[model samples]
Target: MKKLILLLLTAILALGCTACAARPYTPAGEPTGNAALDEQVLALLQELCDPKADLVTNLGAVYDFLCTGITYRATLADTSGGFTDELTDSLALELLQKRKGNCDAQAALTAVLLRRMGCEAQIVQGTFLRADDPEPVDHAWVYAVVNGTDCWFDPLYGGHFAENPRDYFMADDSRMALTHQWDAAAD
Candidate 1:
């Protein structure tokens, strides 16, 4: 009886340690607080990639879905007096319903989706210059750490602007800096 009790305690301790080790890092971004909307987003993610897929594969699926599945709209939501300066729950839901939005919406959706998918992600607000435009314009993109690799995903640039769409996925800081300007220390 004494030996059996010791074995059970050891097993329990091992399981507890495994759980702690497997816990993912605390990710950024806040939830919409709407259960239904959150479910819709998760459902969309499920539709995009298999639940059992690897992190990188899942991230790729999300990028592809955002770029191709949703149309780009060049308008930013007016959030001056609303819940926050950044993307709100209502705005994110509207993006889903309308299937179009500016860079903010794309980046927000990417961040939220990544957070739900068990990856560390954050929405990055910055400025970008188009080759045809002389002035830099406000833009938003996503930075995510996937499978121990720091990567950047730009849905708008990748889908709409880049000559090669794949260039924006998993991009390094130097490559992204060519067109995008942001505070390196902030992120």
Candidate 2:
């Protein structure tokens, strides 16, 4: 009985240690605060408000607000590691603070702000065909159900919509294919 008790205690301790180690890190280089953060962001958005703030107009306003407010910089290997799979609002702030982020950060910030304004928004991972490239480049963007039609907005590309954003909504098709990996589905 004593041996069994000891084994159970050991297992519990091991599990506890694992859970502690697995805690997510707040993204580096961003200010993280509960009240202050919300206030700051809300104030910024309010400044750009239109009296007719419907989903389409509000989302466009927010997208333009972020794109214009935050300057874009390239991702650093050591800091952001080129891309962050966990693209939360805090992570977006971190990237914004550094003035650098990949497509993921841009999409994340856009998605979060849209959601706050009661828009149905989602982050989409996919490839984009740049002007010089025959092949599509790996990219992330926000898809919003705007006016009963799905529209894709790429904040990384100055908040432009893709040619056919609804193409991703085909049967058995997924937005995950646009990402380099399938793990973005978890976000």
Candidate 3:
């Protein structure tokens, strides 16, 4: 728990800048930004970013919204012979339109929303451990600052269809280590 707190603090402090430091939302095949897509993102951001709410609460709302709102499209690999790669920008845009994507799309959307909401955030690629599963699995999620504390969130968990969704929110890195690890090969 202490280690988790430390990691959270480190991440929050590192990304303390108010403006999200990220590339513009120009993904793979898309050349120009779509107004509808921009509105879609802004609409969601407005709903999630409440000035009256504390940053952590607002961020939690964002996490919950994406998890519950987006549909999970599973595949065997990151590429899936399409635009599902964890690091693809195009996947994010596609997710905004399709409303269904695998971990890559979900994570990309989560990171984009966090940045738009004024949190410095990024998507992370990693391996995950499930209790019933025999081995680790590749996955993607988001890391961002919440209420000045660094936090990790798995937006895919939103649609994980589990009873305890909060179990996946604002996790300390150590706790996450039980089920999550950064994929070195993804780099």
Model 3: colliding residue pairs: 67-158
Off by over 4 Å in 3: 1-36, 75-88, 161-163, 183-187
Residue-level lDDT for 43 in candidate 3: 63
Point out the worst 10-residue segment of candidate 1 by lDDT.
22-31
Please give the lDDT score for candidate 1: 0.75
TM-score for each model: 0.75, 0.55, 0.67
Name the best candidate (by lDDT). Answer: 1
- Each prediction's RMSD over C-alphas, in Å, is 8.4, 17.5, 15.8
Ranked candidates, highest TM-score first: 1, 3, 2
Tell me which of candidates 2 and 3 scores higher on TM-score.
Answer: 3
**CA lDDT, every prediction?**
0.75, 0.54, 0.67
TM-score of 3: 0.67
Off by over 4 Å in 2: 1-36, 76-86, 95-99, 159-187
Quote the positional error of residue 104 for candidate 1 in Å: 1.0
lDDT of 2 by residue, 83-187 (tens): 343436565666545646666767667665565565566776656665566776666666676555655556556533334433332112244234233244544
